[model samples]
Target: MDRPSVRRLPRGRHALPPERVARAQRDRLMTAMAEVMSEKGYVKTSVEDVLKRAVISRQSYYQHFTSKLDCFMAAFQRSTALLERQIVEAAAGAGGPVERFDRAVTCFLETLVSDPATARLCVTEVYAAGPEALEHRTAFQQRLGDHVADILEAGTEAGRFTCRLIVAATATMVSGPLLQGDHDALRSLGPRLVAHVRDLKAAGLL
Candidate 1:
């Protein structure tokens, strides 16, 4: 009798078992990449440095990512995800839209002050990392801006606030002082922020 022919799996339908190991290595590398970037900036960090920090071989690095920029993008996304969660959490459970909006701003500013290095990298490194990084950063900013706008729109619809400005303008107005290094003004203006929300609530704009 003729031997039966062996069957082969279709391409791309199943991943190699090694893919899981590769993913684990990639995650560790991304963590190390963020630490290096946060401490040294992208321009100053080398592939070898990342490899050393991650304790992975050069072959393993390339197996998981195409280039340093790829890893940096992953790290950038991770950092932004954490920031977004914090902002959302800070805004959570507020009495009204305006209060929630103010809390979001406060959370963002506090994040900046607390993690200045990471903040600096997020704000300053995009341009230096070239177009791809810039695009990623821009996307993140736009998403955050959209969220801010949503909050403002909610406030407006609820009669908790009155503003003719667009969402972009409203978001900028809400966050401008904090981003522009006017923390003292923000601190002094804290009561005003709260009052603004209160007034909105009282006016039924919230």
Candidate 2:
């Protein structure tokens, strides 16, 4: 009798270990959701679209996220974490308070321009999602403000800056335009934004 012919698994069909498979599925779903949300606003994108894009079934999708909004929230949180890392890295090793603030602003604006989808989702969609979404956004904003306030407090103690306005002003300066969604306006104000940060340093108000 002829030796039994060996069979090969189809391309991209090789079995993955259970943990790897689960991780891969989660990643795929997140990526698909982001793409869908970016192309169509959060309100327009649906769970079915996410499943189709991810090529995962409804059962698999539910296993990962309770709802489409939940998935968007998770994606938004991940984006923010990445953005905060970038801002911190960009500001690291700066010689002065002004330089550090400038680096942070530059990193933030560059991130917005480089990833407009993230900007849109963060700047626009979250608020549009309604009260619960706004509550989540407010929490994030407060955390960021607190972090900036800490930086400002440090600069003041070191005599690198000297003003009580640092906390609220810095928070507003960084987040105001991002919430406005006017790309042209932001671009026009880019130089002014840097100058304002520098002016704060000069006035010891950082």
Candidate 3:
């Protein structure tokens, strides 16, 4: 999705606090990085791409990030953190394991579809950034799998593997349709994924 533009400060000094100015600038930079990386992929994106998209100066980019990889990794961290948090909350509160699992699966799919730019980076572009980025992505998926294992009260190795497998698979399912420009098909994935989860559970995989 296209984020609203960052409101620029006046050409000269303004009343905004230095900290607030810095925060807004950083938001612009990260948002821009997500946008650029999604469109161009990690290997193809450049510092200049982000600079132009963010309307922030090259010097400003350096102050916040050592390089494009650094910025993209930071963005990856931010996006995955939020996704995990949302999933946790969705699985929280008054519900049985089944209900909580449903909520989580639904929320996870919805969040990705709702934010295509960030989803593209987290799901696909990370593979292009080499081992570190892939490790971070895999590790987060592992944690998310463990969390789901806790939700399902299935902390066994088989359970963990199944949960993580489905999580990773679901993400791939999304990236395929998204890359193909089939967003309607992508949005329709939740029910199908949940159905597959049910099959997995029935097979004693969860």
Candidate 4:
């Protein structure tokens, strides 16, 4: 008997494993969600719109997300995580806590200005995403605040800054406005935002 020849996949084309396919679908859905939400507010963006944009089947969308809200949250969370990483990286090389804080704030403002869609998704749609989404947003904001508090604590220890910091409150005060501001607004507010941190040091507010 002659041995059968296996059919090889064409160049740049092959069946992906289940995990890869799933991951790809999730990413596509999230990307489409972001674009659609940016164009239409979260409340108006339908799952059908996202599916059409992503070119994914309803069954595939359901496999990854339970609802449009779930998909929006997923996109928001991922974008926030990326923003966090960008801030961390930008601040990493600064000379000290104050400088690090300044660098981080600048990067954040620049990012928001440069990527209005992401800023809108994070600061605007997040509020309108309903109760659970608000909860997630609040939690992430608190986490960001904690990070700022750590920087303030380090600065205080070094005698570069003073005051006891209510980390979450301070973080919200700093980030809330910047995140919600438009491109031109954030660009103009950059200096003020930095000054706000400096004032925190001056006032011994940490």
Local accuracy by lDDT, each model: 0.64, 0.64, 0.81, 0.69
Ranked candidates, highest TM-score first? 3, 4, 2, 1
Clashes of each: 7, 1, 0, 0
lDDT of 4 by residue, 1-206 (tens): 01111122233667778687687778888878877777887889899998888888899899999999889888888888888778777777647667777777777777766665666777778878899988987777666665665655544443322222333433444355544554665566656765767776676656
lDDT of 2 at 25: 73
lDDT of 2 at 4: 14
Question: Against the hidden true structure, what lDDT does model 4 obtain?
Answer: 0.69
RMSD of each: 11.8, 9.3, 2.2, 9.2
Candidate 2, residues 49-138, lDDT tens digits: the string is 988887888998888899988777876776777776777677678366556766766776776766666766665678667787678766
Candidate 4 regions with alpha-carbon error over 4 angstroms:
1-13, 154-182
Residue pairs clashing, model 4: none
Model number with the top lDDT: 3
Best by TM-score: 3
lDDT of 1: 0.64
Tell me the TM-score of each prediction against the true structure. Answer: 0.64, 0.75, 0.90, 0.78
Residues 1-206 of candidate 1: C-alpha lDDT, one tens digit per residue? 01111222234655567666566677778777765766777899888988888778899889878998988887677678888788777767746566677787677656665654455556655557899988887677767765655665544443322332332343344354534556665455545655765675566564
Candidate 3 residues 1-206, lDDT tens each? Answer: 33444566677867989888788888788888888887888899899999998888999888888988888888888888888888999899988776788888888767777787888888888899989899999999889988888887774688887777777787777788877767678768877776777777777777
